[model samples]
Target: MDARTQWDAGRSEEWADVTPDAARRLLTAAVQAFAERGYHATTTRDIAGRAGMSPAALYIHYRTKEELLYRISGIGHRLALGIVSRARDGGGDPAGRLSAAVQDFVRWHAEHHTTARVVQYELGALGEEHHAEIVALRRETDAAVRSIVEDGVAAGEFDVPDVRGTTRAVLSLCIDVARWFREDGKHTPGEVGELYADLALRMVGYAHK
Candidate 1:
């Protein structure tokens, strides 16, 4: 499916943890504002206005605008980690697991481009502690991919010489989808996922089946 379709299909699944209707609206608005104007440029009033709530209503749930960003980034990172974790935990040899991980990871980046863009690109706006927490979550995600590559290397299923660097490349490639993907683009999320799965497998020297 196209990124838009994919996003709509999976939106609730990714964001279901966020509670209360007002908080959800505020978060939704913050995502748009942050994606369009960057975190530093977006104000709580703008977010509240877009959410159809008064400015003071924003502080009822969040202490500051940074807190709003912290909540969004936290949820986004958790969702990313969950995606990789499920793909890793699902049964497969190294090659199979790697393909599934890459496909799912890439598809999430494409389908959730708006929030993903803020999560991947606009994190610098977060407080130091918040940013550090997100970084820790991201490290777990890296380990998920790296572990698959490591398993493949050990089993002689792949020929990657630099496991750590190769793993980083696989994730970096997937994360870049947020930067350039458009619904009007030639490929849909599923198609892009398939392509990335192949590329990720090739990266680890797993010959196409």
Candidate 2:
């Protein structure tokens, strides 16, 4: 239901709200298909087959493969926005807030790397309108991180000379985790999250007490 729950729920279970169970299965299939084969390379039949449904059944739930991608992107980005925004709005020392933000953000990327890989890397496959909508959500994510950096600078908790650039770097670092993280990796998602959080603090020149 909440962003944290969705993040911890793996790829398919995050679609709990998607009606008809069949639709959810399609989404789950789409995520897997796209992540493995890429949105452009993946076919409607491929998605349908993975979901155990016929090709026509995919149209009953989603108009096109792009639409399915848009839905996945929208859901994933909204959850990501919630994570960063909550950390920004949470009342705490700027250092603490920034660390929390990066921790949770990185954890989500690692925990759901499969779906995340599709949601993040498949942006170029979306239609024009869908692309614009997802971009708008991304800008909000940028703003949320920037605000945290601004707060840190204001409170003398960090020494970031270029708040905007540093915000992008922080977000890029967290988001890129989805690109390389593996379930069988040396570190767990929580360990990766903690490492990234500490690295983010150092990036801002936060002096740990």
Candidate 3:
């Protein structure tokens, strides 16, 4: 595994700062359990056991299992936005920036498949308020991608037919990496990233130009 392809185990001190150590353990454990057994099928006992705590110990940190889902989902969304924002705004032309954005976004989804699966596909499992909040975060990603496409068009670097549709397609392709990517698969995250970046460029008529 290339260091760049490391699955972000969500071990950041930032998340740890807001969440107590035990609570954070539960969250990490929940991500794996939920990813393995799914949100509906996974029990609090499963989560607690995975965290090496009694079932009742879970309540000390979270009111319910859905609460755990919300926190993980929130963290996942922020991580997605943070990565794309950097790729979008950090040094590059429109095409260069969009390529970097697609590559990195796809890599993260593929590398962090378990967490990304829950985040991208399991939003419906959250409470109404939590779902809404996650949707807002998703919109930020959509906007960032769209803006890059717009910039490409404005600069005559891309020949897109529908900026909005194209942006959605680009992100959909990247997000779907979580669904099928496997560690035993042929491509590394870096390889997938490179391949997807080229595909993104081609999608906008980079080669056609």
Task: List residue ranges in candidate 2 displaced over 4 A.
Answer: 1-8
| lDDT value, residue 130 of candidate 2 | 94
Candidate 2, 1-209: lDDT as tens digits? 64445446665556877999999999989999999888889999999999999999899999999999999999999999999999999998898899889998998898889888998898998999999999999999999989998998998889998889989999999999999997767887788889999999999988776
TM-score of predicted structure 3? 0.92
Ranking by lDDT: 2, 1, 3
The local distance difference test score of each candidate is 0.89, 0.90, 0.86
State the lDDT of candidate 1 residue by residue for 75-141, as single tens digits.
9998889889988898879898989999988888888888899999888888899989999999999
Q: List pairs with backbone clashes in candidate 3.
A: none
Poorest 10 consecutive residues of model 1 by lDDT?
1-10
Best by lDDT: 2
Say what the RMSD of model 1 is: 1.4
lDDT for predicted candidate 2 compared with the true structure: 0.90
Give me the overall lDDT of model 1. 0.89
lDDT of 3 by residue, 97-198 (tens): 998999889878887888889887778899999989999999999998889999889999898998999899999999999999987888887789998988
lDDT for 208 (candidate 1): 57
Model 3, runs deviating above 4 Å = 1-5, 8-18, 207-209
Which of 1 and 2 is the better model by TM-score? 1
